[model samples]
Target: MARIKPQALLQQSKKKKGPARISVSTIILFSLIVVLAVFFLHSTYRYWSQRSRIQIEDKESVFKGDDSFLDSKKSDLPGYAVLETAKGSITVELFKDSSPEVVDQFLDLCQRGHFNGMLFRHVIKHYVIQAGDSDKLGAAEDWTSKGKNYNRLYTSLKHEAFMLGTSKTKHDNGAFEIFITTAPIPDLNEKLTVFGKIVKGEDIVQEIEEVDTDEHYRPKSSIAIRRVTLKQSI
Candidate 1:
């Protein structure tokens, strides 16, 4: 049975087809280099932690003291609204000292306007812009129903911004909401209940903290507050 030789059976069929064609071209070039290195590290982690989309300017922020904060909230405790927003207007003063059932249900719903147009959905830039829990308040082309009612699922207070000294920290929600902040969120000292600031507009709260959010950050457009006056005594 010894006879093999047609050029040694074509050199043993080129040594078994040269390592199975170099092991199938080295597994297709190592699976295309591991899918291009996981798409370049997921596009550089979404270009530096994504979170941009701004253009909320019409600006506003005026305050001239009579001890502002809606005049220290109707002279040390009462009710007030004056919401007015598109990118301007803010006045929220209330204090049953720290929050008597969220300032008496937010002064019985801004005395009634319940927050005029309603739509501060939530901004979060320097950190904070939220408006009353949308019952539809402003940016009014025609959308009414600021019923402003609440039992406040939760919140004894502590959501304030700015340290104890004020850089900016107005709040409301005793009935719905009214958030406002810029710099100075000293861990919402004494636990959120700033009552007021933004005497005038605050460059419309940094142009609604340079808005442009969606993936649950909520705030694409619609920051209406159009009306909520009540400079009452303060």
Candidate 2:
């Protein structure tokens, strides 16, 4: 009931209140750190998990020698083919669904060693690397004369000229020739069948693209296809 001085009232108020609490900024900063830590840990876990799964799947695919995992229904997962050239290996993802015949022919040729020792006849920078010339084979006479059974079979494959942006399977005059473009060539879209695309070793593709060429765009130094191996998930 006695009148309290201003100083005494202030002292009483201070004594009644608890210790100073954390600032709102401090609380917000702590929350942010916690969120960031959780996010980083989650991201790291996901990255390693995905990488491990991919390694396992790749190993299995190599051992199995089947690309059942890359069924045509699943456009996301396409069959892979590795072309081991003198320069380096270029792994391509075959669009089996988009151009089944072309893929089939390519695979068949690869299995039969058709592309082996073949030269990259034409390499236009930022355009395409053209190969698969049976004439380039050491035994050109055999190919020309149609003496070899495989050569005859290759010659017999239908060469349908499907319109650009119209049909997925057919193309102008692709036949045994395979053209790997450095960039999107909409002009050649209908003219050539794009069965596969280089997914890995694009640097090697670029290296090949930059190779010295003749007047006809043919590689001056032999850019041979040492071998073609298939790699796909099972």
Candidate 3:
């Protein structure tokens, strides 16, 4: 090949095409996707952050004020329950002052041995474990399913982990069906009467929550409530 001059080579290279310019439509589409992704991520973060924050607040409300809160409500002994199950025993500090009706009903049932031999009919892992429906045991009638005129009680209590509350059935009945929150459930706040919280046997709750369950969330292995013993605070 003949020797090419430096100036000629430079001009020839300059004439060659550069990479094609991106279309405005493509740039717009990319920017829109980036914006949408950021928005979705931000929304997800906010949702989980709110959940976590509520859980933290609930813990403070439930566990931190165990003594002072009870003392303020009743100078006398506070009411509590010892739930003996096949798994283990779970001690619950009842909120008698705040949720008197529900707590009284629960105490009555416990004294009558109504909860004994009742199976935990529902279990949603990391959510809740429920029981107290006599109908599930083939009873004539579930007294819990009676009296649909349940006036919703709103309180500062929340569905914190190990917190005990009444389950709202499809029948919209009385506060007989009880449940324990395996995890913080902010959505359940003000919707149900929170009567108690687990003061001990947190591990037992975790164990029961992890049990194998059917499609209806019923425990396959049968976790029964052996007995419920009431206790008076000293």
Candidate 4:
């Protein structure tokens, strides 16, 4: 082998030193990448855990009504028969007489304040907003959670006059489902069930009809049902 010159020896040393210098930067870059990936994964997992997954088939199903959401002080309170929508304050006079089984079941849910702050998810302008559903709420530990989602069975009765419909009632009478009539809706004459009518607040209902609505019937503003109360007289 030929003897190395001074300049060649220096060049070899420089080459050796260059890799060591690059190694430190490469290690730092790899560590930073690993840290960022770990943080991203943790964030994703936390988001999924906190996200709500209401099943709508987990609430205590009592045909009468159950006071699960209320506190111990109001445990024995009875269910309400009247539903007061906050966006339109329309008073629905439930026809518990026609369909006692379904009405009683719904009344019990109303009394429990199940419909409170619930949105009228299905609002047809000049028609109706079917507003009872518990599955839409987020899964937050702070809020009153029903363990899982609970939905009622679908009623056998077809959509007759004065009747309403809801996606919430895939099973029985849903707690927060309602539909405000658009017009006579003559086509729904004997189809939808007219369980109740707006004793007052027709103007409010009209105003709600005028508000911007989405394809899913969701109102631009959250039209909430403050609470439903049962009354002997309208």
Model 3 ranges off by over 4 Å: 1-78, 134-159, 168-175
Q: Candidates 1 and 3: which is better by lDDT?
A: 3
Query: Arrange candidates by TM-score, highest first: which order?
Result: 3, 2, 4, 1
Best by TM-score: 3
Better of 2 and 3 by lDDT: 3
lDDT, candidates in the order shown: 0.54, 0.63, 0.74, 0.54
Query: Which 10 residues in a row give candidate 1 its minimum summed lDDT?
Result: 139-148
**Cα displacement (Å) at residue 62, model 2:** 32
Which model is ahead, 1 or 4, in terms of TM-score?
Answer: 4
- In Å, residue 215's CA in model 1 sits off its true spot by 5.2
State TM-scores per candidate.
Answer: 0.24, 0.50, 0.55, 0.47
Q: Worst ten-residue run, lDDT, model 4? A: 138-147
lDDT string for model 4 (172-204, tens) is 453435565644443343334455666567676
Candidate 3 residue lDDT tens string, 58-155 = 99888769977767766454487899998899999998778887777787778788888888887777667788664352221232222133233432
**Position 67, candidate 3: lDDT:** 70
The top-ranked prediction according to lDDT is: 3
In model 2, the worst 10-residue window by lDDT is 157-166
Tens digit of lDDT per residue, candidate 1, span 79-122?
54556777666555545455455555556676777767777675
As a TM-score, model 4 comes out at 0.47
